[model samples]
Target: MILTDIVSRIYVLNLPERKDRKKEIEHALKQIGIHWQANQVICWPAIRPSSNNNFPSVGAYGCFLSHVAALQDACHAEHGWALILEDDAVFASDFNTQLPELAKVLSSEQADLIYLGHCHVASETAAPAGLNISTAAVIGAQGYLVRIAYLATLLPYLEACISRPAGHPLGGRLHYDGALSLFRQFNPSCRTWIAQPSWIEQRFSRSDIQAHWWYDRWPLLRQCAAWARKFKQARRHAATLN
Candidate 1:
């Protein structure tokens, strides 16, 4: 199935300052035989207005709003489906080969949403080429396909999260992806799936959404720190379980 047939519009979350990222995604698309310039992913510009609600940072708030804007555009369009891509997305070699199957699975499962890539997936050797979608370990908003009709059900929950809360018994994060998971949780009818061996991965460049003065300047330091802290805590948790 041709992508154009299923996904009528592709929106790339891009910032004006980040021409380099736009170039990278465009090249990746071309490699996969998608003429990005011809198709022209509507480059959604970055917005950074002040957010009164709590977030990790201003960047995080902007990122959340940006995803919302992309989804809104997708919903408004009469397109069949919408492919929302973060500018940092780099396509994989297998991505092109997998498109037809991906399209098929999405149709067969009637998935309202499917992640092209995310943080992790189960190493299911049994069904390598089959749908490796699982219920957990799939988080992040970098790359995903959204069925046009499902947005109506989704937008309310997302918009609700934006409002100054009245009161909720449970604590939850309000980041875009987190809100997505919450929506899926509250409404089991929202069929969500994930692609195995992710079609896209975050480019190794510094993040526009979550950059830090020190980390962006010296990324290796950030990686090393994460490794050191996370690994130590992981081992500690394992010991407690044992």
Candidate 2:
């Protein structure tokens, strides 16, 4: 019901082989003084043959499963809400100060999905803490919140998506982030919201799933890429109202 309560049950989706990400996530949480559980990321090698061909690639399917794994656990947590984070997630400079108000927004609005961090589409306005409603298509899964009630429906939707391909009018593909947005689109009853100035952002990393070796590997390039990302986000944020 409060920020402390939300922080207590955070789940970080991470690949077992990526100890680098694991340690980095731990350090990030430490700075915010929060606790977390590392949910091991699912790998393509372990994927079922039938579902293997469903997604665009092995990495995409793996990412889908990792998020599903986290949702499965979070759906059954003692609390009615769950906060899910990817290992590469970077908190906003003011995340801690703003987080406490989230519980109130969650309670009053009864949002099915709350994007603590997101990308592609920026928040439309400088809405107050409890009022940043998502109006357009959004992407990124670096961090978000899930309501237990919605998770019950979400898990099943995801199960059905395994055989569906991305960009399907009928909710195809299991790429976690895209599917989530699709879920909202198809399920009109599901209410989704975003925390403006986003609570977290996915940092530059040679992703375990997506390709970008130059930016994810070299420190200078990574730093530059990070800057570029910031600039893009700022531009989107500014242009949202126009």
Q: Which candidate is the best by lDDT?
A: 1
lDDT of 2 by residue, 38-122 (tens): 4322221112223446576667787787777777776655456777778888776556777557767766756878888887664
Instruction: Point out where model 1 deviates above 4 Å.
Output: 37-40, 121-133, 164-173, 213-242
For model 2, where is the 10-residue window of minimal lDDT?
A: 40-49
Q: Give the per-residue Cα lDDT of candidate 2 at 182.
A: 78
Candidate 1 minimal-lDDT segment of 10 residues: 164-173
Total clashes in model 2, counting residue pairs 3 or more apart in sequence or in different chains: 3
Model 2, residue pairs in steric clash: 164-173, 165-173, 206-216
Quote the lDDT for 16 in model 1: 77
Number of the predicted model whose TM-score against the real structure is largest: 1
Reference-based TM-score of each model = 0.78, 0.76
